[model samples]
Target: MTPPRVLAVAGSDSCAGAGLQADLKTLASLGCYGMTAVTAVTAQNTRGVSRVMPVPPDMVRAQMEAVLEDIGADAVKIGMLGSPENAEAVGEILGTLKGVPVVLDPVMAAQSGDGLNAEETPRALLAHVMPRVTVMTPNIPEAEKLTGLVVASLDGMEAAARRLVAMGCSNVLLKGGHFGGHDCPDLLFEGETGQLTRFAAPRIETRNDHGTGCTLASALAAYLARGLSLCEAARQAKTYTSGALQGAVSQQLGSGHGPLAHFHSGLL
Candidate 1:
């Protein structure tokens, strides 16, 4: 039998350390079949991003439609669109597939402090894409940018999550890893039911967290494809990322910002 299908609409990472590579790795580890509709192509590595070339809006549309129309998707994970026009294109397509669970990672910057999107990308996501998201995963900085709140603490994180929920997004997972601490806590604010939950994991001290946001969102989507609840998916994804980081703490992957150990099954 074919496995649960998880489609990743994101960018391509040349180093196989982030973007759709991370998504695919997480998906397979979670027993989900992965597909992709690349929105941008990044000249990046464990070090940092050198250049970005966004796929045209029309091409992005074609890629998404091609997968969605054929194999379809049990869940969708969206990452860096890189441009406002591509964001709108995806928004329209996902709007039509409302029943499919969509995990949105508003990737604004790389872990290496490289800027990832155009200035207008976030606005387009907020207006066109966010409302359709089943789970919105944003790091502290992303939450602040998307919600216009000063998220310097956990209380600020809660406030920012609520703000994003109020902005028409379905659920918000405000990630706290960016906040300076050894302990990381992610707050989940569900919009329709007003349910709130927190998933916390101690920070793994390693620069090898390049695609964490992308990995978390993709892992959540993969778990959702397996019929897990939103909270359960988030919790499992958090646990998975924590383990991946812990496993990579000693391994020398790269010079600058490396990648998490996505495969615990020892497959690759």
Candidate 2:
């Protein structure tokens, strides 16, 4: 009867809206115990990221090893690896771990267009981390960056998802929130089944969607840690994200892209 343990490997958000803060909040809200291995420290708010300081590769590895060896997470969510070195370190740590589900939110660019990873980081992730990931969640632009395809339509998103599977990711979730559309559709491509599942939700008309991508990925990791299948995890995560978005309309925290109501579940 123990709660599932979910570890988040990402950056620290000073504004508490995105990155590790959002990951931890989402995990908790989805009924999982949360742990963290910070890869960077950022001075940021809803407006934009002002500065970032990457954590040493050795330190990143040390934190991952310590957490994996001790508390032993049931799942790990990776985000915002600030440098190629950090991504490499994370790849190495994931390689050594066994059985735990890993969800990689290929966070290349921030909500405000701030770049998080270096040019080499995406290649490193594909070469070293994709095979280890249980699922990869990428928005349209990130999908384009990862797969080198123009994701102008849903078909393009599916093609990019298939390419990601070819690149060794077992499952891919191509998010269509960035695309210009009325209905936000997300595609789930299963490598083993070769089936494409679609989840469409009405886009919440709110600017407080800053940490939504991070929240969805973390929620999926939490559910997977709790022994849910990938499809089930995605369903639950989508619902949670929609609810968070809907709840954020009345509570705007920052001047720019505000944060979702992570404490809407009352765990915070």
Candidate 3:
């Protein structure tokens, strides 16, 4: 069987916790072929990101064109682009693709509360990339940043999702991880039907959740590439993410927030 191809346009993580590293791990574990176009190189670990160097926009576009023109992709997952130029470069490529699922994780900041994007990057993404996105996964803070609203409760999440849909998003997955509770509920708002679906799971108590957002978005892309519906793909991705968090509960990798156990399913 041919493995579904997924192209990840993101940054490089030195700790192998997030960005393209996590995307590759998640795609591979889900039996998909993973390709990467690095937008930035980060000097980071489990603790924090100290430095970031954005790849040239032309170089980033070239890498993506080389991959898409040759191997091609069944789906695409986009994370931190580092700069507004990189975002427009990626957006140009996205505009050319047809019938491919694109999962956009609006990664404004890292789990450690460190900024990962330029100040103008969000505006660039909204103008160039958001219209082409198939499934947009944004946490509370990202939703707030993108829509300019206080996303502090479930009602806020729904409203934010609605605003995103109104802004031309095909679908919005407003993650509720920031809310304190025993259960983590993620809201999926479908643009076609203007309906909402809630996916709830027991919050796993673990510090090793560094790449969860990356993992979930990449997993969704993988499943979509394999022909799963949006809701089903989200459900599978959430389950995989939860298992990864649970699997890393007993292990200690770094002093700060560690990485998820992507191989928790023992697929390797």
In model 1, how large is the Cα lDDT of residue 104? Answer: 96
> Largest lDDT belongs to which candidate?
3
Candidate 1 runs further than 4 Å off: 266-268
**TM-score of every model versus the real structure:** 0.97, 0.97, 0.98
Give per-residue lDDT, candidate 3, residue 73. 97
Q: Which tens-of-lDDT digit does each residue in 94-135 have in candidate 2?
A: 988889899999998779999877778888888878889999
Off by over 4 Å in 2: none
Model 1 global lDDT (CA atoms, 0 to 1): 0.90
Full-model lDDT, candidate 2: 0.90
Root-mean-square deviation of every model: 1.4, 1.3, 0.9
Model 3 residue 33 distance off true place after TM-score fit, in angstroms: 0.4
Ranked by TM-score, the better of candidates 1 and 3 is: 3
Model 3 lDDT tens row, 1-268: 7889999999999999999999999999999999999999999999999998999999999999999999999999999999999999999999999999999999988889899989999999999999998999999989999999998889899999999999989999889998999999999999999879999999999888898999999999999999999999998999999998898898788888899999897652
lDDT (C-alpha) at residue 239 in model 3: 91
